[model samples]
Every structure is written in C-alpha cells, then in structure tokens.
Target: MKIVATPIQGVYLVETTPFQDERGSFYRAFCDRELDSLLQGETICQVNVSRTEAVGAIRGLHFQYPPHAEMKLIRCLKGRVWDVAVDLRQDSSTFLKCYQAELSADNAYMMVIPQGCAHGFQVLEAGSELLYLHTAYYEPKSEGGIRYSDPKLNISWPLKVTDVSTRDSSHPLLSEDFRGVVL
Candidate 1:
C-alpha cells in the first residue's frame, strides 16, 4: 500500500497494491504493523458501513470532540463518491483547509482522516457503500458537525444534492465562536 499525504497534516490517501490473478484479485486492505508504524500507535476500535441508495446523497461534515475524537480509514466498497476531509484542528497550520478525492471500488483507494478533521462524502453513483474503520465508537454527546453547504467552506460538491438527513441539514454553520479545540 502507498500512503499519500494530504495538505492537512495527518490526513492521507492510501492506495493498495492489488495482485491480480486468473481467478480474481487480492489486496491487503490494512496491516496493523504498517499502520501502527505510520500513525505511531493509533488504535482502531470499530468498523462501520454506510450504504446509500440514491445518487447525490450527502452524509456528513462530522466529527467528535475530545475524549471521543476518531481517526478514520474510509473507502468506497461498491460504487463511487467524492470524499472530503476538512481540517478543523484550531492550532494546526492548515486549519479550515480541505482535501478531496474520488473513491471508487475500481480504484481501490482509501482515505485516512485524522482525529481533528471533519469527514463527508457525496455519492456519485446510486447504491454506493462506504466502509469505515474508526479509532473510536460513536458518541452522540460528543458528536458535532458543520453544515454540508457552509459558505465559508465552499465545498465543490460533484453532484446536485438529492437527499440529506434532517439532522444533517440542521447542523449549525461553523462560526468564530465555535472554534474547535485541538486535542
């Protein structure tokens, strides 16, 4: 696997080396040794999957606060999506900066979003499935999100948004008073 760093300090785009044969293809999705060395001991404790049934579905801009902050390894399992990560670490040099990548089953690429970043994705194809390996489980009390269409972020979404959860739609915009605290 190859890990490509993003503009944000701890974020990366991981590409797997696939071994193709007559039967099918094989690839190592994750290796504890390799990841432990790279991340210096970040431990993944949970795995989650999200299956979106419609094109243009938007599902985040989400992150958890201190004590429940999560580092995520994400990939598209069945279809395609425009995945995004926004730096929200207040003390980091790249705070507020954003990175985007196209994730599809065909490319077999995954994105690593560090604890201080907010992650989101827009489905580019119907029936897209996203798989995530996280360092922490969900904590509703510590969960927070910014609006997907926040003007300050100006995310260039690839498709016209067709659906969003009511809770996601009601997420507050990030404002000066709401600066995130770095962990």
Candidate 2:
C-alpha cells in the first residue's frame, strides 16, 4: 500500500496493489505500520457501510464539530463513485478547497479524510457500496453538513445527480462569515 498526499494537507489518496489470479484477487486493505504516522496515534473506532442505489445519487458533504470530529478512510467496495473531500480546517491554506477521485472496487483506492473536512460522493454506478473506517463515533448533536450544491464550493459532480436525501439537500449554503472548523 502507498499513501500519497493531496493538495489538502491531511487528505490522502491511498493506493493498494491487489494480487489477481485466474480465480480471484486479494490485497491488504489496511496496514497499521504503513499508516500509523499519518494517523497520529488515533485508532479507528467505528466502521460504516453505505449502499447507494441510484447511478447519480449523492450521499454527503458531511462532518462533525470538534469533540465528535472524525477522520475517515473510505473506499468503494463494490461499483464506483466520484468521491470528494473539502478542506474546512480553520486558517489552512486550502480551506474550502476540493479534492476528488474516482474510487472503484477494481482500483482499490481509498480516500483518507481527516477531521475538519467534509466528505461526500456521487454514485457513478448503480448499487455502489462504500466501506468507511472512522476514528470517531457519530454524534447527532455535533453533526454538520453543507449543501452539495453550495455555490461557494461549486462541486462539479460527475453525473446529473438523480437522487438526494431531503436531509442532505437541506444543508445551508456557506455564509460569508463562515470562518471554518478548528480541529
């Protein structure tokens, strides 16, 4: 496995080489030794799976406030998605900047999203499944989200965006005074 940094400081693109044969393939999804330094002693505390049924469905742009803030390692387990992360760390050079990649089961790539960043994805294939490893547990009171279509971020999703949950679409646009989250 190899970890490559993206434009955003804490965000990373994790690459894995899967051994393929006539019958199947196998690869290490996570190796603590290779990733421990980046994790900074934090351990994954929760694991979640999401399945999006529509080809153009959008699932988030979500994060949590400090105290419940999470670091996510996400990968497409089945099908494909246009994964995205937005840097929302206060005083960071790349605040509000976007980093995106096409994650697919075939590629075996994962996106490492640190705390203070918003995460979301657009389903590129129907029935796309994503597995997430998080360093923090979910907290309703600390939950936060920004509109996927927020003009301030202007995310260029790969598809027509055929489906979106009411909760996600309801997130307010970034305000002029929005300073950013401090991790």
Candidate 3:
C-alpha cells in the first residue's frame, strides 16, 4: 500500500498494488501495519457498504461534529465513483478546499478522509459500490452536512448530477459567517 498526501491536511490517496495471473487478481485491501502511522491510535470502529444503482447518483457531503467526528477510508468495490473530501477544519489552512479522485475496482485505490472533513461521492457507473471503514460509529446527534450544490463551495462534479437524496438536498448552504467545524 502506498499513501500519498493531498493538499488537505489529513486527507490522502492510498494505492494498493494488485497481483494478477491466470487464476485471477488479488490485492491487499487493508493492512494495519502499513497504515499504522496514518491511523495514529484510531482503530476502525464500523464498516459499511453501499451500492448505488443510478449512473449519476450522489450520496453525501456529510460529517460529524466535534466529539463524534470520524475518519474514513473509502474504497471502490464493484464499479466506479468520483469520491470527494472537503476540508472543514476551521483552523486549517486549506479549509473549504476539496480533493477528488476516481476510485474503481481496477484502480485499487482508496481515499483517506480525516475528521473535520466532509465526504461525498458521485457514481460514475451503474451499480457502483463502495466500502467504507470508519474510525467512529454513527451518532445521529452529531451528524452534520453541507449542501452538495452549495454555492460557496462550487464543487466541480465531473458528471451531471442526476440524483440527490432529499436529505442531502435539504442541507443548508454555508453562510458567510459560518466558521466551519472545530476538531
């Protein structure tokens, strides 16, 4: 596994090398040893998977606030997606900036999203599936989000967004006075 840093402070791109032969292909999807430093003392507390059937469905721009903030490692399992992470750390230099990567089964790539950042994805292929490893469990009271079409962020989604959950669409746009989340 190779980890590369993005402009966002704690976000990263992880590349896993897959071995292929006549039998098929095999890849080390996760290695605790390889990610020890990046994870600090945090262990994955929850694992989740989602399959989106539409070609351009969007799922999020979600995060947890303060005490419940979680770090996520996301990978594509069956198809392709345009994964994105936006820095929301109030004290970080890159706050509000976003980094996107194309994650697909063939690429064996994953995106590491740290606490105080919002995560979301747009499906690039039909039936795209994603596996997520989270450092914290879901906490309804701490859940937070920013609108996918927030004018302040102007996220340049690669595909024409064809679907967005009503919950996501209802998230309020960032206001000028919004100070962002504090870790």
Q: Which candidate number would show the highest lDDT if scored against the true structure?
A: 2
Candidate 2, residue 135: the lDDT equals 95
TM-score of 3: 0.98
- The TM-score, computed over Cα atoms with residue i paired to residue i, of candidate 2 is 0.99
For model 1, name the residue pairs that clash.
none
lDDT of 3 by residue, 92-118 (tens): 999899999999999999999999999
TM-score of candidate 1 versus the correct structure, residues matched by position? 0.96
lDDT of every model, 2 decimals = 0.89, 0.95, 0.93
Residues 47-135, model 1: lDDT tens digits: 99999988999999899988999999998988999999998997789888889999998889999998889999999998999999998
Comparing 1 and 2 on lDDT, the stronger one: 2
Q: Which ten residues in a row have the lowest lDDT in candidate 1?
A: 32-41
Candidate 1: stretches off by over 4 Å? none
Lowest summed lDDT window (length 10), candidate 2: 29-38
